[model samples]
Target: MTRVIDSAGSAYFGEAEGLLRAMRLEEALESYALAERSGHDPDACAGGRWMCHMLLGRYERAWEESDAIAARCKPDRHRFWDGKPFEGRRVIVRCLHGLGDTIQFIRYAPLVRERAKTLIVEAQPALKRLIEESRVADAVITWGEREPEWDQQIEIVELPRIFRTTLETIPAKIPYLDLPAAAPIAAYDGATDLKVGIVWASSSYNPARSIPLKQMARIFEAPGTAFFSLQAGAERSELALWRDRIVDAHTDERCVVPAAATLKKLDLIVTADTMMAHLAGAMGRPVWTLLPFHCDWRWMKRGEDSPWYPTMRLFRQPRAGDWESVVDRLQAAIEETIKGRRLVPPGDPGAQAT
Candidate 1:
């Protein structure tokens, strides 16, 4: 017997993959839809559609697409927990993506614990202590370490889908991760000043999420505000040029607890879309996130306030690749806040541009 393949479906799927790789999510989603209509196996395009729905802030639809994506992409080698009612079952949650993703989704650990008798969380090594201290799981283990016995396992990102989360129903509880009792206090001489922590760059792989340090010189020059560097990694070296302009608050990069503790002391945080934004948001601190035109879906399509973090305020680029305008608006907002002006709250039309 011979098998037949849909040539048009394959072409559309290939185009969708290329568009998604180019970060053109909307176009990729259109292509994926076309691929599905042209007789492509729904399983083959489920992951692409899921990514599009997620980036488009269509959470309910994203949730619907998750099951197929999981089945097609991550076939469970062990018993998988798919939000079923299981009593006295040992479950393990695996961390499958970047550190920022682990930080963002670890809040669901406690919710997962409610359905299982024993919950073990496997995370990146850098997050082991933080996750353990959060008390979200019964046991904590880092990846690459010896595996413990568990009856079922699921990825951390899958928890939202398993729980059937919507934009309104996101677990927006703050302070999910706590600082260790022995963590050191962040030292700064800005007791009376408006201490503003800033992060200019993110991981090099996503250059669009980062702002050039030189472009932020005007922000660092703002008066009545003390700037602290919450940056880690190679980008921290840029602080040397502005040593007199910004405080070096870079602690050990291996752990985020110290940085989280440091962020608690700041009056507000101004940062790119990095782990700092997630940490500050998770801690329930006031955070102004500067986003590019094509930002992550969690920030949503058009909103200044995040459904995931109530205390967060967004500053989005007016047009694609136009960080200058965003910076201008950020500088204005900072100056207005410094002068004690009544700023428009998030979700208000006035707050969208500035």
Candidate 2:
């Protein structure tokens, strides 16, 4: 059975939409390419293609497509066009997503800032404060409250590859974040055993991609490992079944302070694909990330490590939503950790071994 239809451009749009809905980025890219080749308006499919590439970690391709669209877009008063005067001389990053991604990719800010008078446009108020705190950008503007009119813009997601990033290229220095001391948090001193921080789920929008809370219960089973719940919101309700054994850090903001003092104090952070993982990785903290079978391509296909963060280790599902095998592997690794074993270093063959 053919996945794409060729009838009256129905097949074309159908295939593109289906691939996009399924998050089959490469397939969607090909569909968009075919659409463009078949005399369809390239701009009509550019935005979809751009998003697909961005999701797939095809930063260079995404930027190229985004640039193509920008070149074709009539110079309007929208914020996207704000960086025109500084175009060739500097890079303008159009920010995307929550505080985590902004902080994760902010590693490239100095690089871009070095080359261009950088301006970051964020969608959240927290992001604006975080960026300013880190001093990552020359200007940290918000997409909240005010939508500044711009002459040119580029997506922040495309920065890493645009700077020609690889695994070795990640800036692994800790304390890159300059969180102020308005609210101070003491180091995790309660646990006498090896502290293990955990995050059960990411935002609900990507449920299929997040490890279920039930699956996370197994992590606490590892011997002598003190598991702390560093999650927000539903953290209390979800981990309540674990009772006193689990550390309830969510009662106060000190648990997951923006400065990351709590996460940094832990020996390891086991989390799903969320800002916590990104923050932990950026801090050069040992992080094991549980991903869905169809994970973001930045994890790459069947990889033990991530190029986006040198300290990150990937624990991808063998099958979608089937966290059994992935959780089993995590359990085994944590057991080894409890046994005084180093628990296979990231990128080691043994680490990738299922």
Name the runs in model 2 displaced over 4 angstroms. 1-8, 16-29, 38-41, 44-58, 74-96, 116-123, 127-133, 137-155, 158-175, 178-187, 251-259, 341-354
Tell me the whole-model lDDT of each prediction, alpha carbons only.
Answer: 0.81, 0.67
The best candidate by lDDT is 1
Tens-digit per-residue lDDT, 17-105, candidate 1? 88865567889989998988888878768768887787767888886776666556556453255655546888888987888788888
As a TM-score, model 2 comes out at 0.74
Candidate 1: lDDT over CA atoms? 0.81
TM-score for all models, in order of appearance:
0.85, 0.74
